[model samples]
Target: MNDDGHPTAWERGVLERLLRDTLIEQRRARRWRIFSRLLTVILVLAVLGLLSTDVTVPQVTSRHTALVQLNGIIAPGTDADADLVIESLRAAYDNTHVAGVVLRIDSPGGSPVQAGRINDEIQRLRKLHPNVPLHAVIDDICASGGYYVAVAAERIYADKASVVGSIGVLMNGFGFVEALDKLGVERRLLTAGAHKGFLDPFSPQHPEDVAHARALLASIHGQFIEVVKQGRGERLKDDPRLFSGLVWTGAQGIELGLVDALGDADSVAREVFKADKLVDYTVQPAYFEKLIRSAGGEAASALVKSLSTTLRWR
Candidate 1:
């Protein structure tokens, strides 16, 4: 509508420009959506690739040494726990190509129950695969529960300075009765059974409870002594101090017949297995499993701290 009342060329040109810009914007948005979808697909593929790699079993050779690491605390939810160690042992033993298995241990020891489970599994696996001799190569320390696990091995090797042996059981706790008395606090604990709160730190110490605890520790210690005797057999020295909860250096361990040889994993792999190639067969927990376990562990630790008074292995 120039001067008359119809339409203006300038207005129509402006409208066309606006329409073109709208079309461009729409195209850009569509392109962005496609790019985002492609990126998501690539990320998913990468995650799948990583998971597959983790799940893949290593190829073994007849001349290769299979390694199962027992590092860190040997307790439930730990790397050297019974479940993981046992699983690794099974994998190493099951592989027909593996000539020998080595349990590389570097632990300060933990739960007796977990250690016992691992020791039993090792014995079972040894019986099943007698030819594939399993050996324990101690690192810095192999004491208490760690030694318990090592005894199951056909031979135990250690460095000259490696600390070995702590052949005993103990249950440690702090007495809070004095502290409570100082604070004028009286612990009002009610139990259905006479021995239900026998070992409570806040309560008065009972002679009968002390005796019971000692008896329990003695029983576990006897079991540990029996295991060592069975595994080492004639190789173990007939010394009373060997099982007196004393730690000895690897050199001393050999003298006491606690260790078979003074060697490391590499030496054992080369000389004993006759193979320099070592393949790890340790079963590591998945990321998700670890996350879940960590959360659960916090809750469990709190519960145990609140309830359990005794019955723990150093």
Candidate 2:
């Protein structure tokens, strides 16, 4: 309505500009929609590809050294748990193209139960696949439960300076009775059995409980010694201090008959297996799986910490 009830030129220009901007916005939205659809498609394809293939290692047709890594605490929920390690071992032994299986151990040791399970599985697999020998290659430190599992291998190899060997059991806890007394605090614990709270850290030390614990530890230690003897056989030297929960360097390990030789995975793979190429068979958990496992592990640790005032072979 510039002068006579008709639209002005400026108003028309403004309307045209608004329409142009609207069209441009619509184009941008459409482009973003297309990009989003493409991204979704790509994600779906990637997930399907992972689901179709082995979750552990890529399939190889050529003969190579099959590698399984045990690179953490050997607890139930840890990466070096018996289930995962044993599963990888099974796959490696089942693979006909695998020249030899290598257990790349870089752990400071953990639960005895988990270690024992892995050790048992390795021995069973060894007997089943007599041709494919399994070897343990220590990276940094393999002590306590780590060495227990390593002894099951056909041969143990380590670097000259790698820390190895801690062949003993331990149960660690803090006695808070003195602190409680000093603070004038009393622990009110109730149990059905007389010896139910025998090893409670907040309670006074009981001689009978201590004796029982020592006996139990000795029993487990004897079992550990038997397994070591069985695995190393004549290679292990008859030393009284060998099972005294002492850690030794890799060179010392070789001298004390704790380690078979001083060699790394690369040299062993090249000379022993004659296959320079190595194929990993360790199971890598998915993102969600890892999240769930982490949560569960945290819960378990809290529970164990609260309740485990007794012995542990760590």
Candidate 3:
């Protein structure tokens, strides 16, 4: 009627319907809001309950214990730190209730000097505490220097599937002089001594230098073999290639006398120590320190790889 024609009943009906629909939506939204609030309250209560719950770390009875965790690249503060490992061993050796020591080793080998230091320290501790039983439980890959360290233990235990033996030294690198020649890149290396840059990749490799380096590595390898013999004694088999830079599994290693038994840390502890409680002596790195260390390790490893590769190329 206002537009110019007639009264519109249909329009009035449509407006009423729209108003009804809007009201229904508002009610649904209010209900959802209430449900959401209730859910949040319940979640908060659950969290508080969990927080208030009493939880206790495992404990040992009438026993003093220590656990030396061998983790990372056998470097300082990286689980396999020699200084930290020896300090823990000393503490456990001195503990009146300990009566035994366990070295929980999980390493892929590392610095010879570090491993040697640990081996020597263990020997010293053994002399100081002859009554204390020292055991090595290989968790995963215990090879080369790791096996060297294990030889110092009174006995070694490992799982059947564990990778155990790499009873030799290895120095790996690459040579890329041909590539450089193709690219027409000149290498400039200066040294006062004639043999100072003997293995320099940029410089032509001399047969004498190659012989010298091989001899040096061979000497180191001989020392490693001697130490292994001193540790395992007659247990080692009559294989010339036993120390020939080969790896073996724990099962095979046991047959080859590389390890004492086929079992894990828990099995060894329970069976040998007659107790279930184990203490870890490895220092726990702070969160920030661990992060920084991880970054630093990556960079150092990269540098070493680069240098070794560059040398081999030349």
TM per candidate comes to: 0.79, 0.79, 0.75
lDDT of 2 by residue, 1-314 (tens): 67798779988899999999999999999999999999999999877665332355567989899999998878865678688888888888878999999999999988888899999999999999999989999999999889999999999999999999888887767688889999999899999998999788889889998998888889998888899899899998888889998889999999888899999888889999998899899875445545666778678776778655645454
lDDT of 3: 0.75
Candidate 1 residue 218 Cα shift, in angstroms, is 0.5
**Which regions of candidate 3 deviate over 4 angstroms?**
1-61, 309-314
**What lDDT is reached at residue 256 by model 1?**
97
Q: Candidate 2 at residue 76, lDDT?
A: 67
Model 1 C-alpha lDDT per residue in residues 1-314, reported as the tens digit of each score: 67788568888898899999999999999999999999999988876654331334687655699999999888766677688888888888878988899999999888889999999999999999989999999999999899999999999999999999988888876688888999999899999998998788888889999999899999999999999999999999989899899999999999999998999988999999997789999888656556655878758875777655655444
- Evaluate model 1: give its TM-score: 0.79
What residue pairs are clashing in model 1? 1-6, 1-7, 1-8
Per residue, candidate 3 scores C-alpha lDDT tens digits across 102-179 of 888888887788888999998888888887788888888888888888899899888888887777766666677887
Which residue pairs collide in model 2, if any? none
Residue-level error in angstroms, candidate 2, position 217? 0.7
Better-scoring candidate (TM-score), 2 or 3: 2
Query: Which candidate achieves the best lDDT against the true structure?
Result: 1
